[model samples]
Target: MAPLEYLRPSDEGAAIALAEADGRACLLAGGTDVVGLLKDGVLAPSRLVDINALPIAGVEIRDGGLSIGALTRLSDVADHPAVRGRFPALAHAVLAAASPQLRNMATVGGSLLQRTRCGYFRDPVTPCNKRAPGTGCSAIDGEHRLHAILGGSDRCIAVHPSDPAVALLALDAVVRTRGSRKERAIPVDDLYLLPGSTPERETLLEHGELIVAVELPATSFAARSCYLKVRERASFEFALVSAAVALDVRGGVIRTARVALGGVAPRPWRARAAEAVLRGSRMTEATIAAAASAAVRDARPREQNAFKVELVRRVLTRVLATAGAGG
Candidate 1:
C-alpha cells in the first residue's frame, strides 16, 4: 500500500474542506472496509480524512423519534436500552451481523456506505465496470452465486451488503447529510442508486457531503418487526438471503405492511409489491406465501444463483410470520 497523508479533522467543516480540495481523499469512519481496500490497491487515495470526530457520535430521542448520529458505533446502537425496547428487531439484526469487535469499531455511516462484496469489484485487475468504466462485468460470466438477482444491469450484478440498513429502510428511516449547503433529509430507500451507466456512483451523496445523522420515524410496525438472515456460517458471514418484515395486523387483517430485502438486490430492496399485497389482507399461510412470491417476481438469477429466488421467498415468508406471531 502507498503511504498517504492522514487528516484527523476536529469538525465536519474541516473534513469537508479537505475532501473538497483533494479529489483522492477518502472518508474514514470505521476502516472495516476502507482499510482492506487500501491495502489491496482497490482504493489508492492520496489523503485519508478521518471523520470520527466531526460532530457525529451521539444518539437521542427527539419529538418521539430517534436520531442516531452518523459516527455512532454499531455496538452502542445495538445495545442501547431504548433501541432494545423500542426497535428490538433492528437490535437483533445488528447483534447478528459481523462480530462483537467489529460492531465496536463499525459506525452507522460506514455500514450504510459499504461497498459490494463481489469479488470482481474488489479485484482491480478483474474486468469490472463498477471498478472502472467500460471494462465489462466479470460477474456476468464468472462465479455469481452471491451477486444480485434484482435491479441489476449488464454492466454490474453486485448485491448491497447490509443487514441492519434493510431493517431501518423498512421502518422509513431518514438520512441527514451536509455538504456545500445546509443539512437535508433523504429517505433511506432513496439513498441507494440503481446499477445503471454509472455503477461507481453508489449513493445519492454528493462528492463532499457529510452524513450527520439518520432519523427514524415512529411506526407501530416497529414493535412487531423481525429480521431473518441466512448465510454460509452461523455468524461472522454476510447474508446469502435476508428479509426484514413489519406489519400492522389488526382484526385478523394487515392494515399496513413494510418489507425490505438484502443480499438479493443491487440495493437495500423495498418490497413495495409484497407490501401492497399484504395491506388490508388476512395474515394466513397462503396469503404470506403469495406476498413472498410477489416479492421475488422480478428476480433474474445467473447460472450459479437461481436458488436465491426461492431462498429469498422463503425467508420473506418466515420473517413476516415471525413478526405477526404475537400481533
Candidate 2:
C-alpha cells in the first residue's frame, strides 16, 4: 500500500481547497469504496481528506419534497420513516446494497460515487480502460457476463453498480453539488457520463466538486413504486438484472410512469420509451409487456450477455405490473 497523508478539514471550504491544491487528493467519506481502492492498489492518492466533520448530514423534508444530505448513511436513509413511506423504491434500493455492515458504513454520496465492481477494473494488474485510459478494456473479449448491455462504447462496457441511483432515476431525483467554483443542481439521471472516448471520466463533477445532497420531488407515483433486483444469490450479491418502476395510475389508466434499469448499463438507464408507452394507457398485461419491450428496444448486448435483454424485459414487466396493481 502507498503511504498516504490524512487531513481532517474542519469546514467544507477547506476540504475543497485541499482537494484543489493537491491534484492527487481524494475525498474520504465512510471509507467504504476508497479504502477498498487503496487496499487493492487501484488508487494511490497523495492525501486523503476526511469529510466526516462536515455538517452535510441530514434527512429532512423541505420544499414539499425530501432533502437527503450527502454524508447520511445508507442504513439511516433506508430506515427513515419518511423515505420508507414516500419512496419505497429508493428505500428498497438502499437496503438492497452490499451487506448490513457495509450499508451501516457507506454514505449516500459515496454510494453514488462508487466505482465499478468489474473484476478487470478492480485488479490493478489487468488492463482496464476505466482504471487506465488508452490501455483498452479487457472485458470486451474476456469475461463480461456482468458487463453493460446499454450505454457502452468501444472503449468500455463496465456496468454501474448503484441500486439507489436506478431508483432515484425513476423517482426523478436531483443532485446538489458544491465546489470551489460554485454550487449547482443536476438531475440524478444526468450526473453520469457515458463511456464514449474517455472511459475514465465517470461523472460530470469537476476536480474539487462534491455532492452535497439529493433532492427528490414529491410525485404521486411514490406511493406506487417498486424496485426489483434479481441476482444469483439472495444477499451480499450484486444484481444481475434490476428494475425500478414508479406508476401513477388513475381509474385503470396511467397518468404518469417512470422506469429505470440497473446491472445492464454504464449508468442508470431510464426507460423513457417505456414511460411513453405507459402514459395514458390502461394498466393491462398487454400494455405492460409492450412497455417492457420498449424499454429494451435499443439494447445492444454482447455475445455472452445476450440473455440480459430478456432478463431486463422480464424484470421491467414484473415491476411495472406490481407497481401498477398496487402490489
Measured by TM-score, the strongest candidate is 2
Highest lDDT: give the candidate number: 2
TM-score of each candidate structure, all chains considered together:
0.98, 0.98
Error of 1 at 277 (Å): 1.0
Q: Residue 130 in model 2: shift from native, Å? A: 1.1
Model 2: CA > 4 A from native: none
On a 0 to 100 scale, what is the lDDT of residue 88 in model 2? Answer: 94
Candidate 1: misplaced stretches above 4 Å? none
TM-score result, candidate 2: 0.98
Clashing pairs in 2: none
Candidate 1 per-residue lDDT over residues 1-327, each given as its tens digit: 899999999988888888878888899999999998998889999999998877778789977778999999899999888777777667877887799999999988788888999998889899998888898999989889899999999899999998888888888889999886667799999999999888888999987788889887888787777788999998999999988888888888899899999999889999899998999999899888989999989888988999999998889878888887852
Candidate 1, 86: how far from true, in Å? 1.4
